[model samples]
Target: MFEKVLIANRGEIALRIHRACREMGIHTVAVHSTADADAMHVRLADESVCIGPPSARDSYLNIPAILSAATITGADAIHPGIGFMAENAQFAEMVEEHGFTFIGPTPEHIRIMGDKVTAKRTVQSLGMPCVPGSDGPLDTVEDALATAKRIGYPVLIKAAAGGGGKGMKVALGPEQLREAYQLARGEARGAFGNDQVYMEKYLAKPRHIEIQVLADTHGNAVHFGERDCSVQRRHQKVVEEGPSPALNAEQRAHIGGIAANVVRELGYRGVGTIEFLFEDGQFYFIEMNTRLQVEHTVTEMITGIDLVREQIRVAAGAPLGYGQDAIRFQGHSIECRINAEHPDTFMPSPGRIDGYHAPGGLGVRVDSALYDGYRIPPHYDSLIAKLVVHGASRNECLMRLRRALEEFVIGGVETSLPLHRRIISEPDFINGSYDIHWLEHLLGLKG
Candidate 1:
């Protein structure tokens, strides 16, 4: 076990890693930007160091500064809590070269899976069902046209190295393809530094389901089941829940096994998620997230497994404590990503937090990095916290989440609480009959 570990990111994820380290008797060193000197994670950690300025390029995402902080603090391992350097394959290699453990998948796996084109090919090799589309990166409009022709109409163009719903465009016919192609390519290049785009058949009204998987260096892998993340705006997830209300028994097992098979084949380590789009009762692989996801707490709540501790233990060369059969998903769990924003228009609202009050009660768990006086930072993601609730059924879980959100209050900044209140009461959402397009349609109706 490592005596100390350095957290390489900020916000609630950083605090989550710090708490996990403390419970495991490991000292934690927090690296923060000049603007984050007084952040919650910095104050809670055992040691702290200022890495760089407020800009992400000079701060949270700066490799040299973080490495120096780890060296100065004598941390043998580094936990890239989320975002920024979490999925940087080259950075993972650098950490290893500096004799510090990167608490995630191997650099080889990260490099292979980070690129959506390469990831799809890898999964295709395993005989998994992938969306009918191009096998590699599409470089030009001509290449995209050919691929779209092969896949049929209503094609989707997406960034090869994209996540969080960025850099995506759909063209319903050939006439619209050229404009959508350039737009998606431009967005992809701006976001991932690679203009590589891929085309796929756009399945209508699909439910987004992802399986949570964990693997050890000892060749052991198991899945904790799936989460329904169809609730979203602009392709980013807002609300998520476990044991999707749409999945039948056989389909659940099949999807879970399909995800687990990929983990074993790729030799993936630590906590990861395999996302798939399910439409008309058929499933198609999308991509895999190479690090811990924001909705990880929902999986933990149902499975009673500390995913962070398991991630650390795997990095330390420890074997998995349980196998496939030993794992079980109990009850339904729901997570609402509470962000500081205008729920109606979904705009960012970062400012001082006054009269803050978080939801509390049985079955209510809030994963946040906030306080009564904490000022929400404008330089990063506007997400302030994740509110997760567990219950025996989906109805019970929704009720708990509704109550929790009602009890939640944060002044001085607009939040999505009112939006959630409306959604939770919507008849379609309550009946679990909504799809990925449902949220967007609701927005259009209000407009």
Candidate 2:
């Protein structure tokens, strides 16, 4: 086991890793920007290092500063908690070259899965299903048009290195293809510095489902199960739940088995997520997240597994002591990503929280680092907390989620609490009949 691990990120996720390390008797080194000197994780970590100034490029993404911090603190491993440098393949290689464990998948796997087009090809070669589209990135408008025509109308142009809905555009017909392709490439260049884009058939009402898998160096791999993340806006997940109301036990087992087998075959290590788009009882591989997902709380709630602890143990060369049969799926679980933003307008709301109170009860958990006077830095993500709830049944989980949302209160800045409350009360959400476009449609963002 590592004596100390440096967390190379910020916000609640950094705190999440810190708590996990603390429970395992591992000290933590929290790296933060100047703006986050007073962050909660920094305060609780055994040691804290100021990596750089407020901008993420200078601080959270500053690889040399982070490596220096780990060296100075004598950290045996570094945990890149979601976003920033979490899925950077070069960063993973650098960590290993510097003689510290990167507590995630191997750099080889990260590199293969970081690019969407390459990931799709690799997984499809492994016999996984994929949406019909171009074999690789389109080199020009003519190439995009050819691929789009082959895939039929309403093709989705996506960036090879894109995420969070950036570098994505949809064209309903040939008339719209040129503009959409150029726009997607432009966005891709701006966001990822790589204008390479690919094409895929756009499913109008697919549900976003992802399977969580964990593997070890001992050739053991197991999947916890799937998360229903269909509730989204602008390609970002909002509400996530386990035991998707759309899938049955057989369907869940089938997908979970496929995910585990893929990891085992790829020699993948630590935690990863295989995301898919489900429609008409078929699953199409969308992309894979090579790091711990923000919605991992819902999977943990349903499976009763400490994923962070498992991730660390795997990085430390510990074998998964069990297999798929030993793993058991329990009750339904739901997680609402409460961002520091307006519910209606959906604008960033960063400021000092005047008053804060988290909901407490059976089956309810709040993962947040916010306090009354802790000023939320405007430079970082707006996600302030995660409200996860579990129950014996989906119905009961819905009821519990409602009560928990009502109890949550944060003053001096707006939040998405009201939006979550409204979503829970909607017929589509309550019945679990909502699709990826449900939330946008409900908000009148889509026609």
Candidate 3:
């Protein structure tokens, strides 16, 4: 076991990792920007370092500074709690090269899955279904046009190395393909420093489902069911639930097995998420997240597994303590991403939190680092907390979620709490029949 672990991110995720480390008797070192000196994670860590200013490029994303902090703190491992350099192949390689363990997949696996084009091809070769599109990256406008025509109208041009909805566009025909392709490439290059773009047949409405798989150095891998993340906006998930309401027992087992097999076949380690688009009762590969997801709480709630602790154990060369059959999943779980943003316009709202009160009840959990006087820095993402709930059934979970949302309180800055309440009250959402486009359609109707 690592004596000390340095967390390489901020906000709720950093705190989440810190809590996990404490439970395992591992000392934690928190690296933060100047603006986060008072951040909860920094306060709770055994030690801390002010890496740089508020800018992410100078702090959380600053590899040299983070490595230096880890070295000075004598950290045996670094846990990049999602975002920033979590999926960066170069970062992973550098960590290992510098003689420190990275609590994630191998650098090679990260590289393979980092590129959208290669990931799709690799998964397809493994017998995973994929949407029909360009076999590889399309280099020119003509190439994109040809691919779009072959794949039919409404094709999606996406960045090969992009996530969080950046570097993506939709074109219904040749007339719109050129601009869309160019824009996607430019955005991809700016966001990920890789302009390679690929095309895929767009599904008008599909549920975003993902399988969470965990592996260890001893060649054991297991999956903990699936999460339905269909309620989304701008290609970002807003609400997520476990044991997808859309899938039955057979389907869950089938997809979960496939996800686990992919990890075992590649000899991968740590925690990873395999995402898919579900339509017409069929699942198609989307992409793989090479780190712990923000919604991992819901999976843990349903499966009774602490993913962070498992991730740390795997990185330390420990074998999985349990097998597939030993794993048992319980009832339904839901997670609502509490962001500091306007409910209607979804604009970022960062400031000092005047009052804060988290709901408490059976099976309700709120993962946050916010305090009454804590100031939300504008330099980071708007997500401030995660409200997760679990119940015996999906219907009961929804009811608990509704009551919990109503009980949540925040002041000084607007939040998405109201929007979540409205969403939970809607018939389609309550019925668990919403798709990827459902949130956008709901907003459009309100407009």
Candidate 4:
């Protein structure tokens, strides 16, 4: 076991990792920007180090400073909590090269799964179902048009190295292909510094489903299950639930088995998510997230597992000690990502939190670092908290989620609480009839 671990990110995830470390009798070193000197994770960690100013590029993403902090603290391992440097293959290699463990997948796996074009080919070769589209990155507008025609109308152009809906464009017909292709490439170049883009046959209504898998260095891999993240806005997940209402027992087992097998074959280590798009009873491989996901809480709730602790254990050369059959799935779980933003306008709301009250009672959990007087710095992501609830069934889980959302309160700054409340009450969401575009349609953003 590692004596000390350095957390290389901020917000609730950092605190989440800190709690897991404490439970395993490991000390933590919290590295933060100047603006987060008083952050809750920093306050709770065994030690804290200020790496840089308020800017994320100067602090959270500063590899040299983070490595220095870990060295000075004598930490044995580093946990790059979601975002920032979490999926950076270079960062993972550097950490191992500098004689510290990276509590995630191998750098080789990260590199293979980082680019969309390569990921699609790799997964397809692994016998996973994939959406029909261009075999590789399109070289020109003519190539894109040819691929779009072959794939039929309404094709989606995506960046080879893109995420969070950036570097993505849709064209409904041949006439719109050139503009959408150029725009997608431009966005790709601006966001990821890579102009490479690929094409896919766009499905009008598809549910965003992902399988959560964990593997050990000892050739053992198991999948917790699937999460239905269909309720999205601009490709950002809002509400996530386990044992998707759309899938039956057979479908769940089939996909889950495939995911576990893939990771085992690839020699993957640590936690990773294999994302897919489900439409018309078929599942299409989209991409893989190499690090821990923000919605991991819901999976943990459904399956009695401490993913962070497992990640740490695997990094320390511990075997899983069990197989897939030993794993059991329990009740249904739901998670609402409460961002510090307006519910209606969807604008960032970062400021001092005057008063805060988290909901309580059985089957309700709120993961947050907010305090009564904590000032939310405007420099980082606006996600302030995660409200996760579990129950015996999906219906019971929704009811519990509704009550938890109503009981929760964060004063002084607007939040998306109201929006979540509205979503839970909607008939589509109540009956699990929503898709990836459902939220945008509900918000009148889509026609």
Which residue runs of candidate 2 sit more than 4 Å off their true CA positions? none
Query: For model 2, how does the per-residue alpha-carbon lDDT over 235-272 read when each residue is reduced to its tens digit?
Result: 98999999899999999999888888988899999999
C-alpha TM-score for every candidate: 0.98, 0.99, 0.98, 0.99
Model 2 residue 135 lDDT score: 97
Clashes of each: 0, 0, 0, 0
For model 3 the TM-score comes to: 0.98
Which pairs of residues collide in candidate 4?
Answer: none
| RMSD vs true structure, all candidates | 1.3, 0.8, 1.3, 0.6
Model 4: number of backbone collisions: 0
Off by over 4 Å in 3: 445-447
Which lDDT value does model 1 have at 66? 88
Query: What ranges in model 1 sit over 4 Å off?
Result: 445-447
Clashing pairs in 1: none
**Candidate 1: tens digits of C-alpha lDDT, residues 1-447:** 999999999988999999999999999999998878878999999999998888999998889898999898999999997889999999999999999999999999998889899999998898778999987888888988888988899999999988876789999887789999999989988988988889999997899999999999888888999999998887889889888989987898898898888898878899899999999998899988899999999899898899999999999999998888898888999999889999887789999888888888888999888888888878999988889999988889998988998899889899998988888899998998888888889878423
* Candidate 3 C-alpha lDDT tens digits along 368-394: 999999999999999999999999998
Candidate with better lDDT, 1 vs 2 = 2
Error at 107, model 2, angstroms: 1.1
Give lDDT tens digits, candidate 4, residues 1-447.
999999999999999999999999999999999999999999999999999999999999999999999999999999999999999999999999999999999999999999999999998898899999999999999999999888898999999999999999999987799899999999999999999999999999999999999999999999999999999999999999998999988899999999999999999999999999999889999999999999999999988899999999999999999888888889899999999999999899999999899998999999999999999999999999999999999999999999999899899999999999999999999999999999999999999
lDDT of 2: 0.95
Model 2 per-residue lDDT at 120: 94
